[model samples]
Target: MGKERDGAGQVRPTTSLSPSAEFPPLSAQDIETLRRLGEQWRVEKPARALPVDPELRPSRPGAARARGPDEAFRPDQPGELTATPAAERPDTSRGRFALRVRRVLLGPPLSSMSMLRERMRKLIALPVLSSDLLSSVAYGPEALLTILVLAGSAALGLSLPIAAALVVLMLAVGASYRQTVRAYPHGAGSYLVASDSIGPRAGLTAAVGLILDYVLTVSVSVAAGIAAITSALPALNPLSVPLSLAVIAALLAGNLRGIRVAGNIFAAPTYLFLVAIGGMTLFGLGQAVARGFTVIPPPPVPATEAISVLLIARAFASGATSMTGIEAVSNAIPALRPVEWRNARTLLTWMISILILLFVGLMLLTHLNGLVPRANETLLSQLAHRTFPHGPWYPIIQAATALVLLLAANTAYNDLPRLLYYMARDAYVPRRFLHMGDRLALTNGLVALSVAAAVILTAFRGRTQALIPLFAVGVFLAFTLSQVGMVNHWRRHRGSGWRRRAAINALGATLSAIVLVTAAITKFASGAWVVVVAVPTLVLLCLGIRRHYDRVRQAVSLHPTPTQLTSAERSEREMAQEFLPQRVHHLLVVPVARFDQAALRALAYVVSLGQPALAVHVSPEDQEADRLRDEWTAWGDHVRLETVVSPHREILEPLAQYIAQLRERQPDITLTVVIPEVVVNRPWQRFLHSQIERRLRRALRRLPGVVVTSMPIHLSEVHPQATR
Candidate 1:
């Protein structure tokens, strides 16, 4: 028999195969039979598994209990069969059993690398990818209004110019990404494109920016959604933080069900929101034009210092929020249907057209009417109320706006995990981030994003305005790097019409750089400084990770030893001199906390093994150690007893250091430690215990040539039958 680890890292046993009896794999059809057998017999626990319950043991069924020489029993569950050791069997304590039931409820474990493909059709792909892009309209135009109103009513007249400039920037970023979609075909987002063209440092810069962007997107979207709700229902405003957290929890659950299911649930809201906004814009404009385009009187401008070029650029920078989610489709090309890139690009085109239609229409209507941003109500909420004045359409538009804002994080939900997966594959993050949970979703990344967003939401007190300044800085930074990288890519490759493509990317790079600087300089005082400090710090960490991986590669490389290995290959070990000691000393030591059935069985098991065994007790002080010794003398076994003094009350490390000294003194002796654990019957009770056995094993496994084992004495375990 030998040891092997399953995909989940659980150790199990394997049997040697002969030529005549090759392993014929079991199929899904045989699963029920295996489960039935599992009910009849307990599985053979592998290394490090807790032992069976020792108290109130059940007598085996008569038929299966009596085995003949030729009768062979095969269990389809993992591990090979062997005679039961002196160690106890599985702890069927209600708590352990309850844990098994809870695991089953969560779902079956996916096979290693068994990634589920959710190739979405174009229809569903639109909402799954564009939720962030389309939902931004709820706040994008308002963001523009927010900046323009700062200079009072005269600056408000410049809304048309600001809106027009933002429109041009939006088109340039959209077209740049469309080219990126074709050039890469696979993910053409900043992380990949910058890595390819501008080197990995540039790529990591983009990666950090995108990570910040995704997390901030979730935070901002949720806050905006809460603003929508509170605007309509002022009474609920007091519960803003709790409401934001609840909505985030719901989104986390939806995404955990998988992207396809999430897309199906969230897609309808995008269409509905589009219709609401589209109808309001058309009717509002039509009514205005029909009444001879009569201008609504503007609010009075307040006296102030002159508006400088910096002030105007700051307004453009603020208006740039409208373009925040435009890069989502490009970043998520793989999430689309077959011919993924082509379908993704087509979907991108539709999203952009609709966005332009609704965004420009709202901008136009804002100019036609004397609308300004209000603290108590959203810009869209005001427009909706004004457009439909006391009708059903007003509430319908507001509801759709709220729903779309809530679902906007779905874009980050879809893309961030995929981004983290890419980062993990490149060794920049922990490997766990690459794993799919039982539900086949990137559960680690999903949960991590949710927690991060929730913290930010609470920290900012659920205010969208407080968080909005931190949004576009990360986005425009990525945009700048992606576009600049593409220019280098096109210039070097010189594909057909490469010069024209290069120029387009160059223009994008230039505009994005300007926006990036403006955003940093204008919003820096208003909290963009946090992002300014964060991106480089994250990039430096990435650099450190790359250095570590490089060092590990060099350490593990076999390139330096090909010739030395040839001489060592001829060296043979004499078993008598190498492994067989003159008189082998097998020392079994049981670590005891008190004298009970647990300690007795541990001692009795080593005695049953017919080895030289002793019981060692660790206590916080000499007084307690002496007391344990005196108690042992009264309730005595014939075995010798030892006491280990732990002055600091540290059980594992002191015992480990003592054992190391013992090993150094007697190099010939082999060490075996047996730990006795009480298995609890309730799910909650398991947490109440310290689980010292686990900590002991962790420490002992680090030592050379030591065997650590556990005997789990179940406090209470229901037998006869349990849910398999």
Candidate 2:
């Protein structure tokens, strides 16, 4: 593959032709033409020179000329190709104070050339991408128990069976995504897959669902981490909301530093949590084996709800939250190093293995030790306390669990911005979301995710139980759509082993759909309705934004045929004619507020253009208009003057009406509205005067065949002899 620049100045990948492909032989005339063009290019190319200070250069006919403030308005002149030395350039750093602060918060900016260096190897990618799936082991079994315990102690025995079912779902979904990586190595995000295989509406629906899922992942993961902290230290219970928000802010700062820095910072906690949980599960199982693998009965409590099919279904739905982040690896394949799809598949397998071992091991240990969910403490904390009753292992386990859970929101942060970038590229969101910051990270999307998560965490008061009901619905909905789309993809482009791939995805889709419907129906009244309503509304909003962009593109696009030309095309053609001075027909209209040095300078520049010039003024009283006319006469009447007297004291309205009339009378001629502006040196001095030029430009932008320009007269230039 090779890279080439498109017309829009973006780099895109192109495939090289095979060596065996046939090509036409070059003729003698074609070879001669190519040789001549190469010689001409070498002769025309400018010579390379070292930068020199403008002040140090000698004053000669062909010497480099210094640029004035007004030079930006004029076209570039030939033989002006000297580079400016850094020392003599204007001090632009004063205006970049905000950029400096961002640098402090997010480190120094990385160049776009360093994008490949930012990719993660499999070792680093595993923990960075699997944190959410791995951290869910801390809460997944507990969520299941919480729902089941409502039917009393008898329902606690059913936890093992429910956990086994969740494991199967995780394996199937993981396998399906592995196939997704192979099929769509570039990116297999749900929106892209569903939009390609299914229709655009289905793709948009999946995009909206995944967006909700990512936002809730951040809020819920932080809340759960805080829950673990308060469980270990009861003194911190009252500070849960504040603590959650603080953790979110920290994640935002770390991620804004770019992908490599974030991955390294967050890599350690996930491994620690895995080791701690893995050790606890092993120790607990060994102790149970010594005790003949007995099942200890849990403490008896009254049943709040009767055991039934509905109750079991709800428990299964809640436990399926463990499968939330399984699809992240497929969506973020590009973040991996070379051989991205293969590395992603290997990482997915490892994640599924670890998640299953921890999830199932914790459930079995809970059943053997007869532990139940408690309001004041988490189940993982309880298991750790029982497994290591006397040593420091319990605290170590709790600390690791809390840290990993807090950083699990990193997974959502990584994938959400990339998804937004894809959507923005397709015009589904604001174009600003497509911009990468100095660090090559999607800064707008990251900030948007942080604000949304903060609002949700505050509203729920950082309670994990309250947020769990709203969690898994969107993720499961996304999973079903993505898998179903893959099935269609395989059927359309069948190759070797295509039938096997389609069957695997079909099974995954069926299982995911069952969970999706179960979660939405069981948790609807609790909080799932919010997601149910939000997904469709967001889909419509995306479609509406796309429609608006389409209309704007059509209105501004140029056509090759003169009869089909748009206003923009005509304006561009007329602008080109400006260089042909003999054929140019333009009228200059200068809007004067009062007769001052700024207005006089603007009038002088307009008169120098040698075009028919007119000066217009709007006065609230008749006396003001009479005084302005007298001043123009005293100034030698360089240009014609037209004054309008208004009783309502409207400035922009009268100026706009006059310009519109000019355009109406001479429809074929271009009207240039030049306004003189006073440029203040100090920022605070700006509030002292009216900004009429700024407002007038906005008011006149809607008029056809009329161009607006500003002629600024600096305060220092107006009073050159004044003291600082």
Candidate 3:
């Protein structure tokens, strides 16, 4: 045995090979062949030397010497070249002004290594995740009352019973989701649960439902927040749509800054709203105690219609929108600190407890104070007035309510992007959604959610009532699917307490399905149909995207045996063989629209490549073709010229057909379409020139074994001497 130093200067033992063993010694011819192969490999892949900063280079005693640039240390071992450190490389892609604006809007970009630091602790996570569920109290009661009020004020008594039922539903869903977090610690939420336990279709259905719910959560939350603002000051009613959009944009900017920063920025308002509501509830109950629990008769108003079972069902369905954001914690378990499942479960429990208390407290106070839904003012606002009519607390509570409502969309902002990222990983959505931005955030998903929410808000004109009907259907659908999937999961993987877990999920599934059906049926005429149609359409879209990706994978995947190739695969294989390096051939074609300096430069570049080059011109008229040929002759005809006169005056189609013909005639050679494009400095100047190269490239890209490249000649570069 002998010792040899490894790449890192670690000594390792090496065993000597015995020539007498099975293998014979190398002959002179074998040694010469190995040497030639090594030389060829070296020629193909030369080692890249990195320049060491003179000040940073370490000095060795008795060997200290200044090194010239050419004498810099070169890596002798293969694949040992050091990459430039990220800290030393500055990205100059974005302009300074654009970067400044981005920094001002989104804060500084966070390194991916800082992901651990970005994870939320319980303090920040609770508010960040629970805002939507908590803030729903501001409008849940109003939606219920608004529906019941259509029948009469007498129907308003059903609010308490409906509220009680909603509390039970919230508990069941929250508990079921706790189990979900334990089961799926990595946090794909309903999509993962349904896909694994049920089927891919079920998972896609659940994902589409969650996606719609998230979009609606943003729109409805912002609209309700604006409603609160307008309720306080009716003068702002005309600007509701604009105000809602602005709030959404602000939320998008905040979240784009990354999770931790958003949590910090949004935490105060959630706590404030909780305190204001809790204090008001306690103070109102105290007043009720002083009055010996008297139920004040609400001021009489004319009944619009007779109260019936359907009216109560519609009210229940509408009020169920309160539970829209409940699944967020389960979906975002990965966003929590260590022991993510436990923290997520704990956070979920706290959210449900707070939500139940606030919701029930507000409902009881609304009854006790005899507050009804009004067009200009929210029920919570009316309750606030009754609780603290004479103090500054009314405005404070109103302000807190408004702020929390607007920011409540943060919950959707947090989970929707993650859910989309999971779907993208599964190839059900566009792959771009899987990418994290410079801030380590799912930027594409966030932007998509923002745009979708903005469109919905604008369509609904930022009216809370108008948007409420479309909200709960998607929410309860996702809940039902998730709970059902969990039930299946518990049954399949029966553990010690599996039966109990199965029972809990079964109860949640039953309740969620009832709510889902109720909402879909009662609110069908009132915009719920939009979500009904949208969900299936989105699901189909996702399936189509997946199918497309699968086909692409099948076509491009390398197979072990040729016998396994399908007919389509065989065709693809035949097309792929044309570009294989074993049969090297090249045909470089330059498409010349006109005989100008740009065309001359492109011809020169192609000729310099020393390949079989041809210059083709597509002219609408014979006179133009003749003129181009004459000009080519005068320019010394550096490359072969072939002009195709198109009497129909189609440029891209004729050129594409000509190239396809070339590829068909010589299927063995690879076609390289070198397009010469005019580069404009100013944005408006691009419109002045014909952008034929872009369209030509797009047309040529469809041909197999045809590579498209552009040689751009900037207007400034066209006349360098003139500029000087």
Candidate 4:
């Protein structure tokens, strides 16, 4: 062996033919072939220079490129990558391995536009869609009687009256929504109808109301469920907030698996709740009527307060929560299987009938048995104890109640994302909200709703009553707006029996408006001001969202596609080109992690492109600055090193400022930033690597003309490249 000098006078090892065999001496042909193989590898080391063919062996699958290192990060379909890759994160890395585990628990990813087969038939859609409305019987009478008994026993008689009025409001709202299903079959909500008929301002206001209702529904239902859970298992009382969050997470996961799957998972609990409550109603009524509705009233009211018209109206509005989720069936018509409208209307009727019977019966039983609400425990718990006594069935009743209430949040999971999808299609929200998740469900919207609800539940300390006064406002607001929209629909299309339809909607609008005003006034001091502020604020946000989308459309809108460009225009090269970027100024900006073989290889790769390049160094102090300066000089000084001084020892900001200065100086140039990165085979080795390149790439991308690219180096053997 001997040493030879490279172009830079660096000594390299030279190989010669030789033989060394353990068992026997090798032949001359074998020795010659081995010598040639070693010489070929020595002649093609990438640290010195790229080979003639310039092919790179990447360390990771899908990181290798057939083109150039500059084009490795370029997306295959450039202009059409609006959806994020995380929604469909491949099972390739540790992060994706965790995602793969989560997917196993949450079910597989659903494809978009494949939800046609995922729709629910009547058998499946009934409990899936009606759980919220039916579950309200768990609290509807309690919210009313809690307010009625304020007169120290004189007010107890008014419970029946308030209950009757609420039932009427439920029927009116349900009938109006039923008509909504018939008129607007392609998914009708207050936002869609009010926008199409009553104008966009009314429509967006309705949208805000629907959003608030859905969010509050999730918070209230989950908190109430947790309350029931803690009541049954008193040991869990201290962990109420955490338990509420966990239940929300469970509901979120189930819904993300697609509607049919989630519906089946939730069906058993809903029917159990129905049987438990329905059985209690019959038992309490049968025993009460046997004794001719005789009851022992509570002793002298501890607190003496008079009841008036406003008090009765407030009580009425609060109890109307039974009707809170009645609009869900109509809002989710598109989610029904084939007979979308017919199945929806049928489910709407079944839900209302069940709601009225169960809710009204529960109210009457509370009247017959003389149970009153207190601050510490829910009235449903009180009724369940009275109906079942300390028996074998009591725990089952409580379990069923808790399960149904928590699953009630599935209503919002189903409707809110679908509604958000509509708004996104019209550019009223972020465009990504329009994407159907891998499971053909709205995963992003589901996550957003869950986070917001979890925050609200935490802030309120998981108390149901605290969230109760904040309810009813959004429900009645949406109800009123949807009714007004339907009135417009009847007037515009006067097809058949339009008079009856218009009058029905007009009546619903009047009744719901009265409830809206009553609820807002009664609960204003009890935290309803938040809703009052939120409604208009959300309306303005939606308006701002629309305005921003319009501006972006104006900014990015091409006057004409290439097909519209004339031959003269194409020849001029101004009006039309294939990609519309008339010129591309390749500016390679490399931020060196350290002056090593990887760094030099990346620099050589960029220099091969023959573009104006910048190599930036952000040093922590003078000593390190001097050290890097010497290191760069020792690496053969092919490109001038640009030193950026950082008095504050910042890494990304100074480099970002330098890039901004470059942009201001070269206003018409496209700047491409090239970064050097290393890939380690073992996943644990990645944690030891510096993340400076990632931070710099993120910060530099905000500039208009800047493009970020990466050149990867492998620490292990050269990996065979693979395509995604």
The TM-scores of all predictions, comma-separated, are: 0.76, 0.86, 0.85, 0.78
lDDT of each: 0.77, 0.82, 0.82, 0.77
For 1-724, candidate 1 gives per-residue lDDT tens digits of 1122222222334221111111223434345544543444432333464476323233564534334443243333445443331122235566567756645554334432333355578999888788888888889888877877777877777878878887777777788888888877666388777877887788888988998999999999999998999999999998989999998998998888666677888899988988888888899999899989886866675735456688778778877887787888877776676687788789888888888888889988877778888999998888887788886887788889999898898889888887776665565666566677655678888998999999999999999999989998999999999999889988888989998888888988888999899989889999999999999999998778756755564343322133434644532122122233433577887888987777877888988877788787879999898888887888765788878887879888888887777677888777898888888867799799898888988898887657788887887643424322
Candidate 3, residue 551: Cα displacement in angstroms equals 1.8
The Cα RMSD of model 2 versus the native structure comes to 7.4
With a 3 Å backbone cut-off (N, CA, C), the pairs that clash in candidate 1 are 52-88, 52-89, 52-90, 95-681
Compared with the true structure, the alpha-carbon lDDT of candidate 1 equals 0.77
Stretches > 4 Å off in candidate 2: 1-99, 560-585, 720-724
- Mark the 10 consecutive residues where model 4 has the least summed lDDT: 14-23
How badly does each model clash, as a count of residue pairs?
A: 4, 0, 0, 3
lDDT of 3: 0.82
lDDT of 3 by residue, 136-187 (tens): 9888888888888887768778889999988888889999999988887777
Deviation from native of the Cα of residue 57 in model 2, angstroms: 9.8
Distance from true location, Cα of 275 in model 3, Å: 0.3
